[model samples]
Target: MDGTLIVGVDGSGAALRALDWAADEAVRGGFPLRIVHASGWEWYEGHEPSFGINRDVVRAQA
Candidate 1:
């Protein structure tokens, strides 16, 4: 959307590879890059809130 390059990624190897590919494509197209991810199992069981979590923090931790 909005001519942006959006990509989804999980913790798996293939997902990471796809993310890298998307980043390259975004750079080549001169488009902004966006990452979109969804929780697969945490909705059923959770600890506290992720209210203040930041994207960079999550990425570094991952």
Candidate 2:
């Protein structure tokens, strides 16, 4: 592939599994891995106290 391997992660078990699979594929295919996390709290009506904190933790783990 000519493009990068993009993976979406939400700090969940499923997202982590997908990330690991994507990373493996990226390594085998020689593609750059891009991990993305979207916090939709800003667009939502209610507040999420763990939104920002979770992003920080995810970033550190990444």
Runs in model 2 lying further than 4 Å from the true structure: 40-62
Q: Encode model 1's per-residue lDDT on 3-56: one tens digit a residue.
A: 999888866788889999999999888989989875567643654457655659
Error of 2 at 10 (Å): 0.5
| Per-residue accuracy of model 2 over 1-62 as CA lDDT, tens digit each | 88899999877899999999999999999999999986555544554666545677645755
Worst 10 residues of 2 by lDDT: 39-48
Reference-based TM-score, model 2:
0.63
Q: lDDT for model 2, please.
A: 0.81
Distance from true location, Cα of 18 in model 2, Å: 0.2
lDDT of candidate 2 at residue 1, scale 0 to 100: 80
For all candidates, the clash counts are: 0, 0
C-alpha RMSD (angstroms) for model 2: 5.2
